[model samples]
Target: MNNPSLISGTTFNEIFAIMEASFPVSEIRTFSGQRALLDNPNYQLFTEKDTEGKTLAFLAAWEFPELRFIEHLAVNPDIRGGGIGNKLMSSYIHRSDKPLLLEVEPPDGELEQRRIGFYERLGFQLNPYSYVQPPLRAGQADLPLRIMTYPQAVTLKEFQRFRDILYTEVYRITVPSSR
Candidate 1:
């Protein structure tokens, strides 16, 4: 399958709608905040569109010197489970050489566990170390989430490094002393 195209201005609103639908309010950045990320050289929004040009799925990624972080991957809810997601992620992994990292909700429920299993089937290993995703919006407390890495599991030091970079760059916040 061909790789998805980089999202353009014309597709921004449609892509954001997919994101808002895929993630909970506390987990997603504000609309303006998301727009700001598009200007960052490290960030990318890849979208798959139908022949008629309607978006089918998207993968939002951040490229750091040491790692490739998948911030979000959402398929159109109407057409999910039809292998679009697998193709999108496989295309990304085929193009990327850096270690790929992503956050997953802890195995708190069946749906969450299935989400983890989805990545696991794609060859990502779940890390056991504790992780807290700093709030994406104001007035929300830190959220506990797990780190999953493609190719292999991460060491404690590696996890800490990933956490530091995400906290500083993506969330724009200082790592709490308690962590």
Candidate 2:
């Protein structure tokens, strides 16, 4: 089995480049903001590299007491469709017993639908409760997203608690409704 190790320094920079290529700017934090997450005790970044030491895939997650929140998961576009993404996710799940939670764009389009299907194949169930992801940067609007939970569905109460933690800890924003 390929071992997933904590990423840092040049490794982190390389993986960040892949993240920028894979996700829209609005969906990701500024590079500096992401770097700051390295200091957070709850944050974790794990990568799988090739013999050449190039990053093949990465999984960034927050290890909260009640849940494991996958902040991002991406594979190098040059070598996708070879199960690298699956391996990364499987490793993450195998290492944690907590219920896993992650946000996803609603399945309104083909790409979005396919992404949801991909998670479902890994045994993650989509939660129907409404959710809004706080903006990664200032002045941007909150993004509407759906929650997917591993092992089972999440109730509105559970979603609300998760949202509060993410808004306060991850984004440092007060949930509008809470205010």
- The lDDT for every candidate, in the order shown, is 0.87, 0.86
For candidate 2, list the clashing residue pairs, or say none: none
Clashes of each: 0, 0
**True-structure lDDT of candidate 1:** 0.87
TM-score of 2: 0.93
lDDT per residue for candidate 1 within 68-122, as digits (tens), equals 9999999988899999899989989877778999999999999999999999999
For each candidate, what TM-score against the reference? 0.93, 0.93
Residue-level lDDT tens digits of model 2 in 1-179: 23334555788798799999999988899899988888898888888889998888888888888888999999999998999999888878888789999899999999999999999999999999888887898888989999999988877888788778877777787667753
What are the RMSDs of all candidates, in order? 2.1, 2.0
